[model samples]
Target: MSETFSDDLIASLPVLRRFALSLCKRGDLADDLVQITAERAFKSRDSYDPATRLDAWLFRILRNAWIDMTRRQKTQGSQIDVVDNPELISIDGRDVVESKISLNQTEEALTNLPDDQRAVLLLVCVEGLSYAEAADTLDVPKGTIMSRLARGRVALAKQLGIKS
Candidate 1:
């Protein structure tokens, strides 16, 4: 509605894109997700609680959209790979190449997790939401989120060849 609102939405794009990529693993799909998120947030702007974290709200919308898309496509597996393009590997000035390597490894590990565990892990660990916050976003009890996070971490460690 205002310049500030537009600015905030623009600032959130990168993280939203990254999160969408984690879910969809396709650049085009992730981009479409980001666009859908932006549009939903705009249309339902009045529903946003001023005191609540906008990022969390937007993430909830993105997660719902991802689920809806999955249902529509009847995805048999959780992971979705993007087209192989050299450009997706292009690092910008702010990227740490070594860290990116680690991130790739982590993504692979994440892919090995059950979809439920992966969603909880990403919302809490990668998205930096508190357990309660993540629980709220996923519409589960706090205890459920905690247990899923714990189990997800254990599963990730195993998948990554790290001892738990």
Candidate 2:
């Protein structure tokens, strides 16, 4: 069981890093977030309910860690630089460049949206989660998820200059 969990964690690292990157927009911080999440997940392995999706459980940890970091930084008042250590979270350069173009656009548009709408867009559009699954992950009503999804789509369309 321990070996299986270790293997699962290894497999999840890449996706988890991507999700963290989306949250932090910095490679080093995202890598740190993934590392912290892995440590927490390993330490609390027993607390993890097998019935729940492991990815969702991991995401909750990463999100909480990010929130905590942001809160701490409020007092520090200085941004951390993790951009130079790109090797820690290796992304193919060509793919990353292509992704950056779209990500920059999408992320900018996403930032303008309300938090609920941004989360819905990430879960549905980026993470490919179904509306029901997203609602479960977010602990919100399905209708709320749907409304956010609709609003997010409209916002993205307008931001991207789509005449719809």
Candidate 3:
């Protein structure tokens, strides 16, 4: 791969971090996951097919790494305590009281979702990927993505006491 390709991958770090944060729900853990994902992506760079979407490839790597880490943690009988970072919670120039309440509710709702449902919702709704693109990223069928997204949305709405 050319230097340009490496730069492009580097440019994706912020989005990767955001996705990681959504998955892990902890800033510190999300940063670590991003680092691991970057290292793995670099080591496996030669395996990357230029014909495929780079973001999708990197996302798959990150998701797989998180899965492995979760499995290891489970086997070890260890639990990670989620630490809330004030910086991560602050929304600049927004209505502080109302926005914070809404944000907290949304975050709580998201956390309540199953991993599979949350992954599809984050990829499609938060990351602005299309259903097909999200399906490709998660290695699921488009129909599966649609169903998960639908269920996730309904669940989130119910949690927020919104009428579906």
Candidate 4:
């Protein structure tokens, strides 16, 4: 790969990791997904179109990788082990506890959303991808993206007890 490609891949890591974590909900698995994405992107560098946005291309790769990982996990009958998160368990102070609780509540609300809505929320809202870009990354129509995002925002607001 050329230096520019390498630089782009490295620059995309933080967003990739965030997106992976949103999909998998485990730091370790998210890291693995990011690694797999980078590897695949590097090996398939020749297939990338230079005219398109690299971040969207990488997001597409990461989303596909997560799908592939989930399919394999299903075939292998894999399940994530649930345990209390340490941040939520902390008793440092009232402020810290409140902050953790608020954060956890938001995350849990996001988690409860349907897979399609959750993916749309993360891609468009959290990752700052335009509707068209998100649609292209997910290989869906722009109308679909807009609809999902609208529904997701309403659902998320309802989950958080916010009037919309």
Candidate 5:
């Protein structure tokens, strides 16, 4: 890989971490997922096409890694520990209490969603991916992405006690 490609990969770390955290819902697990994804991306560097979006490719790789990890955990009959760290809070304003409450509510609602719905919601709504881009990344049809996003939004709204 060239210096530019390496830089691009490095630049995608924050977004990759965010996506992994959204999927795994644990800081430690998300960190491991990101590390594994970086290793895989480096090993498969030659397989990457420069013309394609690097972030999208990385997202796909990370998603696949998370899926594999989940399957392995299921087969092993192992449970993942949920870390109760307050650092996961996303604060948007000066009211710390309100921010924490809202963040917790949103996070809880998100985690309650089915994996497929959560994945699509995070990619399209949170990560700002277009429907077509998300479909390509997930290897699904655009219509599937749309339907999942719709269902996810409605479900999330209901969870948050908001009328859709």
Candidate 6:
């Protein structure tokens, strides 16, 4: 790989992990997904088109890997909770706790969304992909992406008790 391509791949890691976490919900699983995505991207670099965005290509690969993985394993009902770390505690303990609580609530709400809607929301809203890019990444039509995004926004707002 060229140095620039290698650096771009490295820079994309954090965003890749965020999207992986949204898909898998478990940190370890998300890490594995990111690893698989990087490996696949490296091995398939010759197939990449310079015309398209690298990040979008990587997202498509990660989503495919997640699909393949789910087909191989059965998901359990047990959910893992984030353990409190003392290092995170601040001088204003109440404020820290409130922030953590709010974050957890938002995560829980996201976890409750249907997979398609959540994926659409994360790609467009969280990852800052344009609707057409999101559609291409997800292998769906642009109109489908738009409708899913609208429904997802409405559903998420309702869940968070935000007026829409």
**TM-score per model over all chains:** 0.45, 0.48, 0.48, 0.48, 0.48, 0.45
Provide the lowest-lDDT 10-residue window in model 5. Answer: 78-87
Report the C-alpha lDDT of model 6 over 10-43, residue by residue, as the tens digit.
9999999999999999999999999999999998
Off by over 4 Å in 5: 79-164
What lDDT tens digits, residue by residue, belong to model 1 across residues 1-164? 46666788889999999999999999999999999999988888877786887789889999988876775465344543445554455556566877888789999889989988999988876666667668878999999999998999998988778986
RMSD of model 6 against the true structure: 13.4
Per-residue lDDT over 1-164 for candidate 3, one digit per residue giving the tens place of the 0 to 100 score:
66977898899999999999999999998999999999989888989999999999999999987886675565567444446444445456658878888999899999999999999989877776667668878998999999999999999999899998
The Cα error of candidate 3 at residue 61, in Å, is 0.0
Instruction: Give lDDT per model, in order.
Output: 0.84, 0.86, 0.87, 0.88, 0.89, 0.88
Cα RMSDs of all predictions? 14.3, 14.1, 14.0, 13.3, 14.1, 13.4
Q: Model 6, which residues run further than 4 Å from truth? A: 75-164
Residue 41 of model 3 has an lDDT of 90
Worst 10 residues of 3 by lDDT: 78-87
lDDT of 2 at 5: 84
Best-fitting candidate, scored by lDDT: 5
Better of 5 and 6 by TM-score: 5
Measured with C-alpha atoms, the lDDT of residue 13 in candidate 6 is 100
Least accurate 10 contiguous residues by lDDT in model 2:
72-81
Query: Could you tell me how far off, in angstroms, the CA of residue 139 lies in candidate 1 after the best superposition?
Result: 21
Tens-digit lDDT string for candidate 4 (64-110): 88886775565566444446444445456988989999989989999
For model 5, residues 17-52, the per-residue Cα lDDT tens digits are 999999999999999999999999998899999899
Model 1: runs farther than 4 Å from truth? 75-164
